[model samples]
Target: MITDDLIVKMTEFNAGDPKRIQHFIKVYEFAHVIGAKEGLDENTLRILDIASVMHDIGIRPSEEKYGRCDGKLQEREGPAYAREMLAMFSDVTETEIDRVCFLIAHHHTYENVEGLDYRILLEADFLVNAMEDELKKDAIITFRDKVFRTKTGLHLINTMFGLCSI
Candidate 1:
């Protein structure tokens, strides 16, 4: 129920900005699919769901402050916004909030990914970004080989991009 509530909040937060609303929605779908396929436990799946939606929460703030929102700025600004939004729900515990914030802060960080949730988040975001950015086949392939770890994620990227498996 918190996930649903958070979705509404995020939708409202990004009001008049369909691009961001749709971006988060797409990321959430990919995260859900990749998380399920990767067999995440219930708690982790819940965290992944929340993190996926709130991953870019800082974009607005970053843009407002800096006139541009890059990955590092988003990572820096996202956790506070995520925390504020998460505070609205009593159901989300501190532990959960901490992990969700951590995920948001590191969503764009690629090196030494630890948890399944983190890895899946990266894969899901990359999947959406690759299409949204209209990246070339070679770039997709490079990311697929270098970044994607889960079989489902790799398959989706390869299939979506029409890249033959290496």
Candidate 2:
């Protein structure tokens, strides 16, 4: 399966860096949970899974080129690396590749989201990032209001970050 292949390749691509490996793996896991709970069809789920694993594929290259891996750099350098890594698999269709690449390119852009897959990727990455980055309550609430739309994604953000007084 491409998911398995992606895991292996992502792991290899992030070798010797447990933090990077764990970040992608955690993002993939959250994306899997939210995608399934949100009832994404098989095709969308597959693309989400692939995109989650390969979302940060540009981090290394960005850091190498610009000495930092900010959102713009990742967005700029990610699609090409993602395309190359995805090309190693034969089952992934051109449409799938295009869609995943699109999601990766826009994952950091919160406004003008165009699809469920894109929204979920942002939610999933934010879910992991909230904890990884130790985001504060105000930022979490602001993002929850501005970015999150799906029921499942919003619920996860609220519960995970204690946005609501329960």
Candidate 3:
């Protein structure tokens, strides 16, 4: 039930700067592309995309409070905003909200990718991040087998970044 409107609102809320806003949008786009390739159900795909857009909601406050934006603050501050904003979407249940919030809460950590939905979003975010971080040199061999968890994600990353497939 989560709509594109909700995703936009959360992205705007979480992203204070143009770069941050753009980052979330890119992550969401990556998520959507992967969802199509992975054949995720509509509802599940909505949650994944919404979660991807809202993933860094805590970064703003994290920077303010700790003078740095990092995983601990995301785990600490992200879910609360996700819970509050997600309330507007009637189709989004508490359980779905909690799951999305949980992913946002733990996004920077790689320990929680056991689930396919989360794994897909995580890899999508990493694909975008690796590009943003200019980690292009190792886009293939170094992380060819490491960061990518899906065939679709690997394809997108390799193709878009101009890296030869592994």
Computed on alpha carbons, the lDDT of every model, listed in order, comes to 0.93, 0.90, 0.79
lDDT per residue as tens, model 1, 1-166:
7778888999999889999999999999999999998899999999999999999999999999999999999999999999998998988999999999999999889999999999999999999999999999899888888889998998898898889976
Q: TM-score per candidate, in order?
A: 0.98, 0.96, 0.88
Clashing pairs in 1: none
State residue 163's C-alpha deviation in candidate 2, in Å: 1.8
Model with the higher lDDT, candidate 2 or 3: 2
Relative to the true structure, candidate 2 reaches a TM of: 0.96
The residue-by-residue lDDT of candidate 3 on 45-159, one tens digit each, is 8778888888888888788888997778777898887888888778778888988987887787776466767888778887878878888565544765775778898888778
TM-score of 3: 0.88
Candidate 2 local lDDT, 37-130, one digit each (tens) = 9999999999999999999998999988999999988998999999998888988999999999998899899889988899999999999998
Structural RMSD, model 2 = 1.4
Largest TM-score belongs to which candidate? 1
Q: Which of the two, 1 or 3, has more lDDT?
A: 1
- Assess the local accuracy of residue 64 in candidate 2 as a C-alpha lDDT between 0 and 100: 88
Q: Sorted by TM-score, highest first, which candidate order results?
A: 1, 2, 3
Q: List candidate 2 segments past 4 Å from native.
A: none
